[model samples]
Target: MVVEKNAPLQPCNTFGIAARAQTLVRVRSVDDLLAVLADPELAPAPKFVLGGGSNIILTGDVKPVVLKMEIKGLRLVEETPKAWIVEAGAGEVWHDAVAWTLAHGYPGLENLALIPGTVGASPVQNIGAYGVELQDRFESLDAIDLATGQSFSLDAAQCGFGYRDSVFKHAPSEAQDGSGLPRGMGLAGRAVITHVRFRLPKPWKPVLGYLDLERRRAEAGVEHPSAEQIFDWICDIRRAKLPDPAVVGNAGSFFKNPTVSPDQCADIIAREPKIVHYPMPDGSIKLAAGWLIDACGWKGKSIGKAGVYEKQALVLVNRGRGAESVTGGEVMTLAKAIQTSVYERFGIRLEPEPVVV
Candidate 1:
């Protein structure tokens, strides 16, 4: 186990906030992690599992020991008449994994192309794009409990997946939400996801319900689009709207699309008829968070070094670089301000999507 001290973190996080981890370990395999657990000096320390660093805000220097997951692999684990079961190492680049599946003739993850982060963090964030979400294709996952150094696996239901949320995203608690998950026993900071398996259905169907995908399909006049076609369209759409994390520091959409009841939607529609919203099958309405922020006139606006992306108000970007880089404080301050303005105007509280460390 190679232990690094005072490791630079700016390069690790997508937001480009300059920070450092006091101690870091690069875990490439289960044995590597077990070795750390057996080390008396490192065994009892509180740990933070880091993947591609695409969805986090570093508030300050991280004090907990950082276990940088770098486990790597991609393979077809099983093949049935109904579905193709594919497995990926937790640290495998997410987009690469998606493309790999497509190249190998598996088509289910095409709509999710170009999404940033690693496979392990996919389920942790329940990452989705276009009209598809990770939970929709999830099979199961392998993880190791940090406290016990024991391995475990969980299926979709055990993950307690919600919109951009999962058991790994929650803090340790015993509060059951009656969602069939041991929700009360949240796994936040307590386990490390090592691998993920995706169940891609056999008679593949493309999920094109999202407005953007629908518009693209029509614009291209694609009546019966293939998986690769959807993949190309999504990549183009995202690149046009979202700033690349490598070129411009950002954490993708900064807020989750807020869901509201029918009555609440009716009231909002009465006041803001131009609002962009969608009806979910569950009888709730999901409002476009970008429209709300833009409606509040925050597009391309800045607070300190943190600014809302001009092209997409839903994204928060770092306006400064190096020593002048946006502090996590600035980002949070701007996020709070946006939340306040949206609530004051719409009576809806916007929830941020990134994890603050």
Candidate 2:
């Protein structure tokens, strides 16, 4: 493992923010990670882990040893008639995993295709798209405890997964009686996720939850498409709708589709009638933030070099003079403006989906 000082981070993060890490460590395996953690010279300094850097915004230079997880591999642990347990290294790209699953006929993750970031970072945010979340197929994950340098595993229930949160995202403040202080750990520092296991169904029917996909299936004169067809369609739709991050700088949906109470949705519906809402299992309604923002006329609006993408109201694009010129402050300004506009329009505040560092 080699530690570099003042490392340029613009290339690492998908946001294309020009920032530097005080110390950047690239570890290829578990032993490599432990070797750095055990170094006497680097003990007390703060540490932060960087996966694919697809879901984070670098505001400024980060202080600490930015440990970039480079561990990589994919293998099938167990397989049955219904499901297959597959393990992926933390450093493996999420899209690669989805592609591999689709190639092997695994069904659940096909809907989540084209999502950016690393497999290790998926469970931390419980990443969901096109009606599929990581928790839906998550078997368990092994994380290295930074303090003790020991490995631990967590099942779905123990992960404390919510809409877009997990125990790794939000750590406890104090010690609990029987619960043992909730570990006081989150996705950032205390625990570094090294590997993730997913239980994907092999012999399964397709999930046609999203309206657009359902419409496409109907257009093709097929009520139920096969898994491979659905996967291909999803990839096509994503490529059409979302800006390719490789060509443009983006972190998927900048803001999450805010969920409101059923009564609130009903009230809004009474006023606007045409406002669309998806009823959640808990009775809360998931209001489309894109529609709200478009109604407020924020789509394609630009501030400095950063602006909402003309094609996707939810995606904030970097169209400034140069990639390095774009700043987090500018992005935050635009996000806050959109949030304020939506609040004034419908009494709902929009929250960002990506982790803003």
Candidate 3:
């Protein structure tokens, strides 16, 4: 573990916010993590578990010890006639894990390709795209309590997953020194996830749940496609639609598609009549956040160094304004404006998908 003080975090986050961490630790193993936590020189501040630097916006200098999770391992544990259990280290890059499963002929994770982040953080947000979620095949996870340094396992249900949220984010509040802290941040439960395990389907049948995917697959003359074909189609669509984080600074979709009741959906549709919405089987309705933002004329709009990417409205791209730049603040301001406008226009508040500090 390499610990540094006053570390520059601009290169660490996807938004490229010019921020500083009071202390930053690059943890290579579980023991390294324990040693860093045991050190008294490190302040007892709230910790932030960083994976692949995707899905986060650094507002300013992060005060907590920035733990760079780097644990890595991948393996096939069990194989039956129908399915296989693939267990991966928490620090393994998510997309790599997905590809590895595919190469080994495992079926379930092919839908999730090119997603940026670690296997550990996937479950934290219940990351979903193209009609597949991490929780759908999640078997269990191993995490360490920040306070006790004790490790434990949590089953799928214990994760409290609900539409891009989990117990890790909404843990019960516990006492803090002065700040209003949560229990999960305290001794009893301030857990830092280390390793995660997943069960994948063998001979996987591709799920064509998303309309965009179905349309594209058909247009490509692909019918009754296998998992590999579906995965390739999704990759092509994502490549065409989203900006590569390596080339441009961005955390995938900035906001989640808002879910509304059937009656609310009807009202919005009645006004525009052409508004696009995906109806949930549960009778709820999902309104596209990108469409709403674009309707408000926010696409390609720039405020200072931060602006909505001309290619994708839902993605806020940093124009490489350095630490002294105001790009980070501007991006937040624009997101808030979009959220407010969409709420007023359709009575639906778009929630941010990336973790904001």
Candidate 4:
């Protein structure tokens, strides 16, 4: 457990925000984490667990003791006739893990390829793209209780997965039993995910219902696409649609596509017939947030050093470089402005996807 003071965090986060971790510790293994907790001076302090830093915004210097997860490993834990169980360390790059699984002949994670962040952060947001979400492939995960230093595992149902939501996103309340466990459904700051296991079912099939993917399939003139082909197509599609964070410094989609009732969708459609919306399986409509922001004339617009991505209005970018990069305040300001505009125009509140710290 190596602890560094005033550690620079610009390189750690995908958004390239200039910030520092007041007290930072690199946790490469479960033993490192246990050591931190056993330390007399550091054990009592508040801590923040950081993964790939793709889904977070740093407002200022982080005050909590930063526990940067760097645990690394990937292995086939179990193999049965029905499915292959693959396990990944919390520190492994998410896209690389997905590619590794594909390269090793496991095929279910193809649709989730090219997504930013680490494997540990996937279930936290129920990260999804195209026709599949993390919940669709998740088997179970091992996490440690920050309060008690006791470890536990959870299956998919125990995760309480909703659209881009899970128990990990909520803060624990004061309704704990004698065991210091949360009574209701919250884990927010009390758990540190260590490893994630994915169950890739046998007899793989390509998930290609998304319009872009369908077009790719039609263009290629292939009725039955292989998992590798779908993976390549998704990569190409994402490359065309989203600016690489290495070049444009962004946190993928800035907002979650808001869901509305059928009546609400009908009302909005009456006012704006060209609104982009999709009918979900549960009788709800998912509006395209990019379309809403673009409709409000916000694309290619900037508020200070923070700007809306020109190619995708749903993304927020940092226009400045290095130390002069956009501050978290600037990013939030632009996000709020967009949210207010969208809400006033469509009567729907847009929710941001990234965690604001």
Report lDDT per candidate: 0.92, 0.83, 0.80, 0.94
State the displacement of the C-alpha of residue 127, model 4, in Å, after optimal TM-score superposition: 0.3
lDDT of 2 by residue, 203-316 (tens): 776778788898789889986687778878888898888888778888888888889898888899988788768988888899887888888898889887788988879888
For each candidate in turn, the TM-score is: 0.96, 0.95, 0.92, 0.98
Residue range 80-135, candidate 4, lDDT tens digits = 99899999999999999999999999989999999999999999999999989999
1-357 per-residue lDDT for model 1 (tens digits) = 688999999999999999999999999999999998998988999899999999999999999899999999999999999999999999999999999999999889998899999999999999998778999999999998787787889999989998999899878775544432234538888789999999999899888877788898899898999999999989999999999998889999999999999999999999999999989989999999999999999999999999999999999999998888999999999999999999999999999999988
Model 2, CA-based lDDT: 0.83
Local lDDT at 259 for model 4: 98
List candidate 3 segments past 4 Å from native: 43-45, 173-189, 321-326
Given candidate 2, what's the lDDT at residue 327? 88
Candidate 2, residue 184: the lDDT equals 42
Question: Candidate 3's residue-wise lDDT over 236-344, tens digit each?
Answer: 8888888887677788899988888989888898996877789876889988888899888989987777778887788888776564454567778878888888888
Sort by TM-score, best first.
4, 1, 2, 3
User: Comparing 1 and 2 by TM-score, which wins?
Assistant: 1
- Candidate 4 has what TM-score? 0.98
Q: Which has the better TM-score: candidate 2, or candidate 4?
A: 4
